[model samples]
Target: MSAIRSATVSDLEPLSQLLDDYRRFYAQPSDPAAARAFLAQRLGAADSRLLVHAGQAGALSGFVQLYPVLSTVSLAPRWLLNDLYVHPEARGRGIGRALMQAAATLAREHGVPRLTLSTQTHNKAAQALYESLGWQRNDAFHGYTLTLD
Candidate 1:
């Protein structure tokens, strides 16, 4: 069967709750309030792209967030895939994969070259899924970040 459609602001609450659980699964702090706030911002942003999977019982199963960006040198539009989460209770239902496929489809429709995301080194499960999806491992460099303050 075909996957569902891209999500809109109306899905913010359900999407946020699912995100909280996804984070918690990775040992992150469980904070639904913070999750809601973050999701709300993405919902309100014009450049944000969300794809969701709704279960047969009408519950949200998964979601992926894509942010619009531009290449610094080439000046071409691109998409930064920020978050991908499948609810624990709804795992093995192909929600995550479907959402990812939907995200890629959207990016392609907009003429974007690729979809990019990251997982921690220890998150082998996620890495497996990404690899299974044919994502390449960028071994040429390491990821780094600096706190803004």
Candidate 2:
């Protein structure tokens, strides 16, 4: 298995492609330019951590992005595992698991108290993988979102 490392500006092109594909998976239209711009903004703001796995010939196989957040109840820092994606050709190769593990490791290194993520309820495969990694599903609170746009 290839090692997962922090994504840099040099990875923009491939990383943007991966992001585009990931968005498409969620029913979003293809927009490579927008993907690149969004990722570049995140990189520039330094508000998120992006970890990428390289496949054959140094191509990116997968990526995981984390955003720092605070847990008011605990008065401590936590991380939101915002985005995780593995190329279709790279699926079933453990890349996703590796990316997730790397994210956890990064959070630990930063002294984060916890990491949180959410997925579509129908995404059983991702839920299974996360569960296998010891990530527990929250049963105590209901999640709600409002879109202003």
Candidate 3:
């Protein structure tokens, strides 16, 4: 049976490989070293919460990363899910859903009233998966992001 738990610094290597594959799946350049450094910062600095699913010698089968944020008006804590990836070879094995379920549990434990995430407009497969997992479209809101150069 696979188990999910909070990710620590030691899981960086496997988590890095998974992140690299995830980015490549969406057409990003493959760079395992960059992935390693990025994961290192996230885990080392304690700026984000990353959960991993592993079994037998700690193979990272899947992962989800969340960034804690706050609501502007009420100042209530919320969690933004930044990344959710399941290794392609592990697809159809329910690892993705397991990660999400664990994420929700984490949010609850942290006293977060809600969890939020965004996906590319063209990613119908991921949207479907999210909807099936109880996420809904926010027709009343638009998401805008600014990139720093």
Candidate 4:
């Protein structure tokens, strides 16, 4: 089934739900309303691009969101694959790979020099998929996070 496409405002509901599920996967509390508003804000600002995967029966099974970034050394634009989520039911069907490829294509078309993403270290499945798609794991630099609140 043709399942992937650039998401539009028409996909807001499903996209919001999927995003909330993604947050929950990271141990965040469920907040569907917050998810909706967040996505709406992002879409309205045009600061990011979201691609959706509509599985069987037009269900919104997965999505990937990209944000633009710049490589200081290269002095070229790049893409940060900020979020990627495929519903549990949609796993193992190559949707994730397809979405990654689509994101790469979009970046390349826009003259982006590279695309980058970071997944939880424990997410072996995602690592495998990314490695299989030629994504090199960054072993050179340590990643750090700081909580603002």
What's the TM-score of each model vs. the native?
Answer: 0.88, 0.97, 0.93, 0.96
Better of 3 and 4 by TM-score: 4
lDDT digits (tens) for residues 69-146 of candidate 1:
888767788788888888777778777788777888888999998777888889787788888888899888789999
Q: Candidate 3: deviation at residue 74, Å?
A: 3.3
Tens-digit lDDT string for candidate 3 (1-149): 67999998888888999999999988999999999999988887999999999966678889999999999866799899989999888888888888998999999998998899999999887888889999989999888889999
Instruction: Assess the local accuracy of residue 135 in candidate 3 as a C-alpha lDDT between 0 and 100.
Output: 93
Pairs with steric clashes in candidate 2: none
The pairs that clash in candidate 4 are none
- Candidate 1 clashing pairs? none
Clashing residue pairs in candidate 3 are: none
Give the lowest summed-lDDT range of ten residues in model 3.
53-62
Which tens-of-lDDT digit does each residue in 1-149 have in candidate 2?
37789999999999999999999999999999999999999999999999999976788999999999999899999999999999989899899999999999999999997999999999999999999999999999999999997
Could you tell me the lDDT of residue 133 within candidate 4? 92
Q: Which stretches in model 2 have alpha-carbon errors above 4 Å? A: none
Q: Where is the poorest 10-residue window by lDDT in model 1?
A: 1-10
| Candidate-wise lDDT, in order | 0.81, 0.95, 0.90, 0.91
- Candidate 2 RMSD to the correct structure: 0.9
- In Å, residue 4's CA in model 4 sits off its true spot by 1.3
The root-mean-square deviation over C-alpha atoms between each candidate and the true structure, in angstroms, is 2.0, 0.9, 1.3, 1.0
